[model samples]
Target: MTIDDHKSHLVTLGKFLKQFQVTGSKKDEEIPGNDRFFEDFDQKIDNAIHYNGWFTRENIIFALQQWSEALTPQNLKWWLGDYNLNQSGGKTVGIVMAGNIPLVGFHDFISVLVSNHKVLVKQSSHDKQLLPVIAAYLMNLDSRYENRIEFTKGKLEDFDAVIATGSDNTARYFEYYFKGKPSIIRKNRNSVAIITGNETKEELAKLGEDIFRYYGLGCRNVSKLYIPKDYNFDNFFQAIYEWNPIINREKYANNYDYNKAVYLMSEFKLLDNGFLMLKEDKNFGSPIATLFYEIYSDETELEKNLEEHSEKIQCVVKLHPGKKEVKFGHTQKPQLWDYADNIDTIDFLSIL
Candidate 1:
């Protein structure tokens, strides 16, 4: 199939996803084959939550809505505008997706197919349901996709290049295993926000969404804070009070209680707001229900330190646009062109 054919199918898939949202599921009669897929999809959403406690209904809908907004004709065109897709007899690209958040590795999945290469997908066990169902819907839209997309439960073989996302340890394994082939092996990275003691209350509230969305499981979630020396956190705590109900969830509350106990036993100082804890630390990857923080004395020195540790950071949120910085509230709402880890997946696949 041609690239235009691929684009059309993805557009249809996006429209299909739009029907299912947190408020309600509205079936659009204009979408073809909805009658066959919608019922099964409704069940899959339920199954997704049952299979993984973190996959709540609201988070699933949010992920679907983001993809629905991203797969538009204009967005796809803009994202792939500079790529050459005319290569014949393309190789198979193996993708090992991460399940930290729902549909986390979908960009890689779509990138391979849109670049006219066949994809061999090895989905993370934590996220086993959603993508396969969507893949079936795509095949129903165009039989050509059936020949191009394949999912594996066993070892991945017969692939020219590989893209794998995992922890720092698994990344070492991937690098050693796929050393002979062109590969992109990703490791653990966390996001952080820089507070200059000047952000508006509304911006900080939105920043709370960056911290609490998907229960802060995704790599895009801001797990750390960079604040000026002696900066008061009263405004930040007040702005994020709305998300306090997150503690009602069993898993999150357990983590909060356990981490708080550990800190108390160790005699470490903590700032607690009942649901979340803020601790002074130098690390980026904080545990659930906790956020690590550090005080900065100078902006120039802070920038230099952050740049020095850029490899360990995924995103840096700030009020103003700076180098590799995202807006306060926009970390979770990434655009279609927002490549993960600053690596261009489409560009990587096009050359392979």
Candidate 2:
């Protein structure tokens, strides 16, 4: 595939998604009245949409917009050019998808598509539906990509470059297993929000979506919070409260029970919000739902502290203005122009 091929594939995918939303299912509702394919997902679609404590459309929109806009070769080339590279020839890439979030593996999909390469995608069981929908749309738009993108459920050792996203433990396996291969082995990460004295209720609510969405299973989910000394927890709690009605009560209660069992009796120092838990001392790209945070005093120190946790901190959410940080809540969404892991992914791929 070529850069032009990349554009063709994405535009097709977007249109198909729109169609799926319209006719697919009511629960799968797309951008109001534009498409109808959502009628297909049936009730499962409803649950996916209304499934509390996971992802919200705002963040997904944030991600999808970037994904959609980055479809063109100009955007792809512009992104690659920043790192002084451009797509040259085709390649075969093995991508192991992480099903933590709805479409977490899509980034690798973009990388593979834009770099004039063939993607050997190993779909996750948790998200079997999405990739097919995406592939269907892309294929509908251009037949050329119908065979280029495939769903594989196997291990690969032949690809030129490899990208794998999984838990810290799984990453260890990937590293030792895939050793000597040019790879990007992403470990677990969690998003955290730094409360810098300027957040409003609206922003806080959005942050709630970032935290609770996908049952806090997503790598981009915020598992920690950093606040100034003696900060009012009430304001933060109140904002999160607006989402209380939607919180998966059973899941919340389960996590609450687990934490209380460990903390109240076991003498664990777990910071909790009655729905979530917080604990310190870890190094992974993610944290579990029952536990989510570490308290910090000055954010500047935490910011510096973040360098140490770089391998595991996915996105951080902050309502503090003028901050271009990789803080909490910003995990799922990324600008095409942004270089992840301090390296230009597209740029690097283009050179290969």
Model 1 alpha-carbon drift over 4 Å, by segment: none
Q: Estimate each model's TM-score.
A: 0.98, 0.78
Screening candidate 1 with a backbone cut-off below 3 angstroms (N, C-alpha, C), the clashing residue pairs are none
User: Model 2: per-residue lDDT, tens digit, 1-352?
Assistant: 4555665556545533433232222232433322433444333334444643344454344444546555555665565554422535467778888765666778778777766677788876665555665665565556767766777767775678788878779999989988887788877556666777567776777777677765577655677676666666677777887656543556556765765686668776765665655555443333345544455776678878876777666665676534456533455556666544445566557767
Number of clashes in every candidate structure? 0, 40
lDDT of 1 by residue, 66-177 (tens): 9999999998898877888788337899999988888998998988888888899999888988999898999999988899899999888999999999999999999998
lDDT of model number 1: 0.91
Candidate 2 lDDT at 207 equals 79
**Root-mean-square deviation (CA) per prediction:** 1.1, 4.8
